[model samples]
Target: MSRFRKLSQSIWHCQYHIVWVPKYRYKVLQGAIAVEVENCIRAFSEQQKCEVIELNVQIDHVHLLVMVPPKVSISDYVGTLKGRTAIRVFNRFRKLKEKPYWGNRFWTRGYCVDTVGLDAEMIQKYVKYQQKKEQVAEQRDLFNR
Candidate 1:
């Protein structure tokens, strides 16, 4: 095996950038709802023995940057994170109700995962920028209407 691959395999410190949107991009999450979601993320991180470096919760989507052990699969980690958060958020907040917070599934089927390198600032900025862009688009839509 390549030395780099061997070294990566030996030392498990992988930063994952994951994003999941609500089933229909509903504007159901607000205020305390966002806080609950953040809490859930932290809980999941603890459960998986991972560290959440940063998180950004928007009205319809969530962005998380976490450092996880190599044994954890990205798919499984994301599934658990999304599932746990959705359940906790819906349960704690009345606004979610039964219809909009989640359909058959809490999160969309797929998520984006990017592995971070020595310089993770770019990824952090990108995630932050995503939320800003969405806010801009939302404001534009409101004005247009």
Candidate 2:
């Protein structure tokens, strides 16, 4: 049921469900902080050309289902998302500076990532059909010219 993205030479639908927690798993994400965290992730994902299919900000952790391009690195994306959001969150909530987190890191070192896949047969068939559709469209345009 997922949609595929077409590139010049590739078509892909790479998605992942990712989870991570705050340093020490503190229950600090609430109210303003929760909203800010969500906004920050959305903005960052847009800048990276990634799509956030779903997101949930809990008091101690976050769950994000994102659709990323095949060319992007999963580890790099998660790192950037966490690191940049941490800086922005800290800047907005200066009181958090008082927290005793080592090196002032917001999120923990490790995270969870799982791929989202549709039925293999369905994806193969869709891609196979898409190629033919594109070829027909190209031929039609040539005839119209």
Which model scores highest in TM-score?
A: 2
- Once fitted onto the true fold, the runs of candidate 1 whose alpha carbons sit more than 4 angstroms away are 1-9, 133-145
- Native-referenced Cα lDDT, model 2: 0.83
* Clashing pairs for predicted structure model 1, backbone only: none
How does residue 124 of candidate 2 score in lDDT?
A: 40
Which stretches of candidate 2 lie above 4 Å from their native place?
119-145
Please provide, for model 2 over 58-143, each residue's C-alpha lDDT reduced to its tens digit, 9 standing for 90 to 100: 77788787889988899999999999999999999988987566367988999998787864344344434543565688899999
lDDT of 1: 0.77
| lDDT for each residue of candidate 1 in 1-145, tens digit (9 for 90 to 100) | 5212223438555887887787777765568888888888898899988888788888888888888877878888888888887778767764556565455465677887888886678888887788788879989999999
* TM-scores for all predictions: 0.77, 0.78
lDDT of each: 0.77, 0.83
* Residue 27 displacement in candidate 1 (angstroms): 2.1
